[model samples]
Target: MSEGFEKCHNEYTLFTKTSKEGKILIVNLYVDDLIFTDNDEFMFLEFKNSMVRELDMNDMGRMRYFLGVEVLQRYDGIYISKIKYALEIL
Candidate 1:
């Protein structure tokens, strides 16, 4: 995680790394779950692979839900909602 990654001063759970070309990779840790994304596909894969190799964690593929919030990733953009959470409470 030391490959130019720096901890966010205000957020201990957030880490960010920047490539020389200015591409950014972001990682967020919540409890035991980790979510990461990178602007560059090659770099993203490299980072993901590295993490998988070092940590005993499974890649659950794409994310659908997190912390009771639904996430929808579309070609156009990403969407999130709490409708499922609300329904469960009803």
Candidate 2:
């Protein structure tokens, strides 16, 4: 992943990328699931395509839930929660 992103002009940070255009892209890899997000849609698609070319990955569309966290996208902004996880613990 690091090498692939570097080829796309992205700075690596353990698990994040700051594009040359100053857009932030984050990727969290679990056992077999991967979740990612970016500020720019065009840049995001570009990166996604690059990943697809370099690696065998399946695009899961928009992220609705990841690692027990529920993701909510609204007109105003994005909201994330661990309500399901919390309930399980309680």
What lDDT is reached at residue 56 by model 1?
Answer: 94
TM-score of 1: 0.92
**Model 2 error, position 43 (Å):** 1.8
Question: Over the stretch 17-87, how does candidate 2's per-residue lDDT look in tens digits?
Answer: 67777887766666766667778888678778988998899887777877788999887899999998899
The segments of candidate 1 whose C-alpha lies over 4 angstroms from its true place after superposition are none
Residues forming the 10-long window of minimal summed lDDT in candidate 2 = 5-14
Q: Positional deviation of 36 in candidate 2, in angstroms?
A: 1.1
- In candidate 2, position 89 carries an lDDT of 92
Weakest ten-residue segment in model 1 by summed lDDT: 37-46
Q: Supply the global lDDT for candidate 2.
A: 0.73
The number of the candidate with the highest TM-score is 1
Per-residue alpha-carbon lDDT of candidate 1 for residues 1-90, written as tens digits (9 for 90 to 100): 578889999999999999889999999999998899877998889989898899998999889999899999887888999999999999
